[model samples]
Target: MPNLSTTYLGVPLKSPLVVAASSISSHVDRVQMAESAGAGALVIRSLFEEQIQLDSMQLDEFLAAGSDSFSEATSFFPKIEHGGSKEHLMWVEKTRKAVSMPIFASLNAVSPGAWVTYAKQLARTGVNGLEVNLYSVPTDMGKSGSDIEKALYEVIESIKAEVALPVAVKLSPYYTSPANVIKQLEQHGAGAVVLFNRFLQPDIDPDTETLVNEMVLSNPAELRVPLRWAALLYGRTRLDLAVNTGVHTGRDAIKALLAGATVVQVASTLLQNGIPYLSTMLLDIQNWMDERGYKSLDDFRGKVSQKHCDDPFAFERAQYVKLLSSIH
Candidate 1:
């Protein structure tokens, strides 16, 4: 067997295949299964700002439901203040205790205050690191791309100021200049960046004339974007690159490593197939390494990236032009 141990966000992992944040973490058994199946790390599902707000609203409604019926009705309930984040925090702490593998907490928030506040709370959960899920759809026509990027930096800066844990930013792929953005994130104290947060776009049901907000899992074909970015950024920046969004198999993970990704975060494959499938993916990587006489992941990592590859232009537009020209 070959060595698969690697470090991600300064934390040592037994394998490079990490389990991405998803509903899989909602179940403690599934999380433990992932750890047993050879996942490098597990990012717990995000504590979304909306969830917190909704929880608070529900609590208020419960407290005021029959308060006006009588003076003692208000006193019938205890004056305990509750927030959804607290439940999520307890869950994270519990998950951290249940597994020995690195447990990463994820947060998705809009405002800088929310980011910093919850980031501080999550940091106290004894998790190995934090993954800031920067997931948002820009609906403001007046907001420039620079404006959005600035907000992201401000949120990250605020969180870094309040939290001491290693922070990894899960970035959206819609940025005009991704390399510069990753460089700026590193400058702002991000330890790693998960390439390309998959956006769940809503679809319209033509027959029913209704908008359908269904869950659509990612396919293997979605790996190209992050693979290209990883190859382009391999030797250019100090930030650890975690290729996300489309990794589905061991070959996909190998491609990510070849492109210099520090780790590959997977969620769709496990959800679609099964959690135990993680072991299969890891086995495939180990077998491939053994057959090639590669002793460790570092031996082949980034070997085909743009920085060291024989055909550098394969990752550039020249290759696309060549492919188009070769059509006849």
Candidate 2:
């Protein structure tokens, strides 16, 4: 049997396959099942700052509407009990008590203050680490790329200064230079970088011509983006790389490791195949490692990375001009 143990964000994991933040953490039973199914670690469902802000605003509106009776009735059980930050903190505490595996609490905030504040609260939950789901869509015409990047760094720095737990940033791939962004995050004390958060894109309904929110699961092809970036940044940085988005099987996890990823996070696969499938993926990876005579993860990890590969130019290309000219 091969040793599948690995370390992520300085925390020891029994395996490199982690259950990414998804609907899995909604219940304690499911989280325990994932642990038994061979997941090294689990990221709890994210606490969205937008959700907290909306709840706060609604509570204030009710209080100011002269509905003293209603407000008094809801006072015993504050808005925090309904959908505020307190609920998430309580849930994290409960989950931590239920499992011995590393449980990382996730926070998705848009503002620097919100990020720092929530990070501190989450740290008090006794979680092993924190994952910052930096969910931002740069739609404003007045905002430049540098402006958006500055906001990201500020939030990271603020959280780092306030929290004691290890912090990992789940980044979006739409940046002009992802490597540069990762470097900036590391400088701000990020322990790990989760490559390419999958964004929910809106679709239009042909009949009504209205936009609809779609929840489409990622495909295996989506792994390529993170793979390339992970390979490109392998030897250049000291920060741990966590490949996410579209990872479906154990072989996919192996591919990520070969590209120099410290760990591979999977959500769509477990959701589609059920949590027990984690065991199967782990078995597949072990089998592959044994067949290749690789005793440990480091044996074959980064073997195919841009830094180790013969042709580094494949990772950095311009228009495929050479390939097109050769084809004709």
Candidate 3:
């Protein structure tokens, strides 16, 4: 059997397959199952800024609802706050204690202060690292690309200053200069950059005239986008690059490694196929390595990247023209 060990964000992973942040940590039993199933590590479901804000507003509404009708009615109910980030922090702490494998806490905060505060608090949970989910919908037309990027830089800077844990920024693929954005993050002490976050799109119901938001699992076809970027940016940056989205099987994990990813983060597959399926993917990679006479992951990692591949243009617009002409 080939050695499957790989280092991600300065942390040594027994394997290169990590469970991406999702509802997987909602149950401690599921997390333990993933560890047993051969997951390199698991990121706890993100503590979102919007969710914290919504919770605060709801608490205010509940506290003020019956204050006018009957002052005593408000007193009868405890002034305790519920649905806040306190539960999330406590849950992360609990999850950290439950699993012996490396566990990273995911955080998504809106304000700079909140980013620093929450990141610091999450670090205190005794987790291995932090995945700063810079997940947001940039709808402001007035905001220039530079302005938006500056805000992201500030968030990274703030978190780095307050948190001692290894920080990996989970970036949105919407940036005009994704490479430049990553360069700044690297300069700001980012341990790793998860290639691209899969931001959910809201769809409108034609008849009902309302937005319907739902969970949609990624398919193998979606791997191309991150694969190209990972290949293109390979050898160009020092920061560890993690591939996320579209990693459904062992072959899919191989594709990411070939494209120069330090590791691959998978979520949808485990959701659709169960956590134990991770062992199947790892087996596939190992079998393929053995067949090829490769001793370890590094033997063929980035073997097909732009820096090492014969046809570098295959990852860029040059291939688009070639592909179009060949189709007809």
Candidate 4:
């Protein structure tokens, strides 16, 4: 068997396939199952700032109403139970004790101060690393791209200054210039970058005139966007790249490595196909490596990146030109 050990963000992983942040960590049994099944690492479910703020507002409203019945409403605030920065820290510490594998804590913050404060607290939890789930929808027409980018940088810098643990930023694909944003993030002390976090999009029901909020898992086709960006950014920056969003199989993970990704983070696939599927994925990668006569991940990783590939223009040039020319 070939060695599958690889390093991500300076932390050694048993393999390159990490279990992305999802409902898997909500229960201890699920997390242990993932490890036993062969996950390299695991990111705990994200603690969303929006959910915390909404709960706080509800608690305040209940208190102001001055109803004795409001006492029971306090349970609605998960932060008071398992969602606060301190509570999250404890959870990480507990999870670390439960499993020997590397565990990374995740946080979704809206403000720079909250980002810094929570990152510091999470660092004390004994996690191997931290993942910043940074996301914001630009609903205001007055805000320019520069303004949004500045906010992202400020948050990254604040968190970097406050914590000693390795930090990875999970970004949205809606940026006007993702390459520039990633370059700036690395300059500001980010250890790694997770390509493309899938956002929850709202849909409208025209017949019923209702709005719907759904949690749709990513499909395999979603891998192309990150693959192209990873190829273009490889050898250009120092930060490690972990591709997420649409990675569903061992072959998909191999495609990401060929595109210069340091590791592949998967969630939707494991959710769709039970946790044990991770073991099969790792086995498949090892078998492929053996057949190719590659003993280690570094032997073939990034061999097909834009900088390494013969047809560099294929990743950037418009495909329409080829289609139109061939039609004649």
Which runs of model 1 end up more than 4 angstroms from their true locations? 68-72, 326-328
Give the Cα-based TM-score of candidate 3 against the true structure. 0.97
Clash pairs of candidate 4? none
Mind giving the per-residue lDDT tens digits that candidate 4 earns over 260-316?
A: 999999999999999999998998898889999989888887888888999888788
Off by over 4 Å in 2: 60-83, 322-328
Worst lDDT 10-window in candidate 1: 75-84
Best by TM-score: 3
lDDT of 3 by residue, 1-328 (tens): 8999988877889999999999888999999999999999899999998899998988788778867679688778786777568899999999999988889999988887888888888898999999999888888999889998888888887788877889999988888889899899999889899978998889999999999999899999989889988998889999898999999999999999999999999999999999999999999999999999999999998999999999877777747876788975
Q: Model 4: what TM-score?
A: 0.92
Task: Point out the higher-scoring one by TM-score: 2 or 3.
Answer: 3
Instruction: Rate residue 85 of model 4 by lDDT.
Output: 60
Arranged by lDDT with the best first, the candidates are: 1, 3, 2, 4
* Candidate models: Cα lDDT each: 0.93, 0.90, 0.90, 0.87
Top candidate (lDDT) = 1
Query: Residue 327: error of model 4 in Å?
Result: 6.9
Which portions of model 3 miss their true places by more than 4 Å? none
1-328, model 1: which lDDT tens digit per residue? 8999999999999999999999999999999999999999999999999988988888888778768777798878778586568889999999999999999999998767888889999999999999999889999999999999999999888888888899999999889999999999999999999998999999999999999999999999999999999999999999999999889999999999999999999999999999999999999999999999999999999998999989888888848777888997
Alpha carbon lDDT at 247, candidate 2: 88
Q: Rate residue 196 of model 3 by lDDT.
A: 83
lDDT of 1 at 317: 81
Q: Name the better of 1 and 4 by TM-score.
A: 1
Q: Candidate 3: RMSD over Cα atoms?
A: 1.3
